[model samples]
Target: MICDRFYFESIDSLHVKINKLIESVAIIAIKMQNDLRQTSM
Candidate 1:
């Protein structure tokens, strides 16, 4: 029972970390796109 709980918690933490990474990547992409538009203009 203890082992199962620990395994579940680890999976939960990993999922949270992945979500944060994706969010940051999306923000960076938006910033890069804005920069490209500014340069073109």
Candidate 2:
């Protein structure tokens, strides 16, 4: 039972990390889009 609980905790931590990474990528993408638009103009 302890092992199963630990496994679920680990999975939860991984999910949090993935969410952070995705948010970072999204911010970068938005910045790039803005840069492209400014340059095009």
Best candidate (score: TM-score):
2
Show where candidate 1 strays beyond 4 Å. Answer: none
Model 2 alpha-carbon miss at residue 18, Å: 0.3
TM-score of each: 0.96, 0.97
Ten consecutive residues with minimal summed lDDT in candidate 2?
1-10
Give the alpha carbon lDDT tens digit for every residue of 1-41 in model 1. 99999999999999999999999999999999999999999
Instruction: Give the per-residue lDDT of model 2 (tens digit) for 1-41.
Output: 99999999999999999999999999999999999999999
Clashes of each: 0, 0
Native-to-model Cα distance after best TM-score fit, residue 35 in candidate 1, in Å: 0.3
C-alpha lDDT of all candidate models, in order = 1.00, 1.00
Q: Give the C-alpha lDDT of model 2.
A: 1.00
lDDT of 1 at 35: 100
